[model samples]
Target: MVVSNIISGYQKTQKLSVAPFRQMQSAFDRDCLFTEKIYIIGYSFGDKHINEMIRVAITHNPNVKIIIIDPSYKDEKAKKAILEIWSDEIITPQVENMKFGEFLKQQIK
Candidate 1:
């Protein structure tokens, strides 16, 4: 999927004019994909990035869902708090730190 960052109210393309926001929207529209069925996975340095991704995904597809696996950062409590907030979306079916194989299996089911 395409990825981009929102900066100062404007979308800054890290690459070419092939901006991430446009690309992501195109992918979804072309495929006639459903936002609720889509998943965004991230970890570590990706913690904030993943949030940004979800923000963008939701802006484009309001019904989109997200799943994040952020191991305790700053503190365990903070991580737990973030996970709780992440649970608000109805489309989010699961959120955990399972192995890649296990995550894949669960997603497929």
Candidate 2:
């Protein structure tokens, strides 16, 4: 059985009504608020809900650290674009310009 609450495509009117989605969102918010470090991987910052949660978390916890890992961020333009998404907040997230596999290998070493 596959249980997913993913909003596919550009359906802007779709709302997350499933219990699992709610639970997951709640957990994500809790983790964002309490966790000292957040490592983001391959997220495009397209989801408004997720972005808003992250913004709120940053605002609530100014000392929390953010680490973003994405190969595209190797380019200065791409890194700037990602940073611009959160321009409203005063943050300088540590960026890892590498693929997930490479990051995992480094972590295992």
Candidate 3:
């Protein structure tokens, strides 16, 4: 299941453009608004900006559920950042350090 999309992003010139980033932000924002649950898997995303967008999405959808699956739990920082944003508020987000296959079998069921 290798899905892909052609969206505006960084170019080869090593220059940062505002339009593409904003486009992504707008798209993710809309996605967050409509989705009832978000399953974010893996640390391969490796982008702080993208992680921030996820956090903001969680904020936009207060009652939404978030399931984070990252082995080694190295991406705990991203989760911590989200907690800080909504201090004293419990979002009931679940974090798991499990292999993708295990998650599919045990969690998806």
Candidate 4:
């Protein structure tokens, strides 16, 4: 798995004096090249970055299915506009406001 490789790579190179963030980004880029799909899960501040990444990824991989697990979709118009544009491309454009337990249950099923 890409995630496993990421963690293992991090562990192996923790003391290698390289910028871990850059290395991880490179790893993700390489893995994504041949990846059929990607499931990005994030919460809180990470939620912001993940949302941004989703936009960027979707721009590149227009058909890549995305799941925005718990984004703050408080802006109704913005949410609707985004869904209109990206619904077909994403697995679920808005799972943001759902309770974590319910979201997990739905995802598993």
lDDT of 4 by residue, 4-104 (tens): 22333234334323566556656665555446566444433223333445555666766666455544545564455366444555544444566567677
Best by lDDT: 2
Ranking by TM-score: 2, 3, 4, 1
Candidate 3 has its poorest 10 consecutive residues by lDDT at 7-16
**lDDT (Cα) of model 1:** 0.47
Clashing residue pairs, backbone N/CA/C < 3 A, model 4: none
For each candidate in turn, give its C-alpha RMSD to the true structure in angstroms: 7.2, 2.7, 5.3, 7.9
Candidate 2, backbone clash total:
0
Model 3's TM-score against the true structure: 0.58
lDDT of each: 0.47, 0.76, 0.63, 0.50
State the local distance difference test value for candidate 2: 0.76
- lDDT tens digits by residue: candidate 3, 70-106: 7766645655645554344467558788987899899
Error of 1 at 87 (Å): 12
**81 in model 1: Cα distance from truth in Å?**
10
lDDT string, candidate 2, 4-104, tens digits: 65656764334454566677777888999998998889877767777777778888999888888988875664465356446777787788989999999
- Superposed model 4: Cα runs more than 4 Å off: 1-18, 31-56, 76-96
Best by the TM-score measure:
2
Pairs of colliding residues, candidate 1 = none
Once fitted onto the true fold, the runs of candidate 2 whose alpha carbons sit more than 4 angstroms away are 10-15, 74-85
Residue 104 local lDDT, model 1: 79
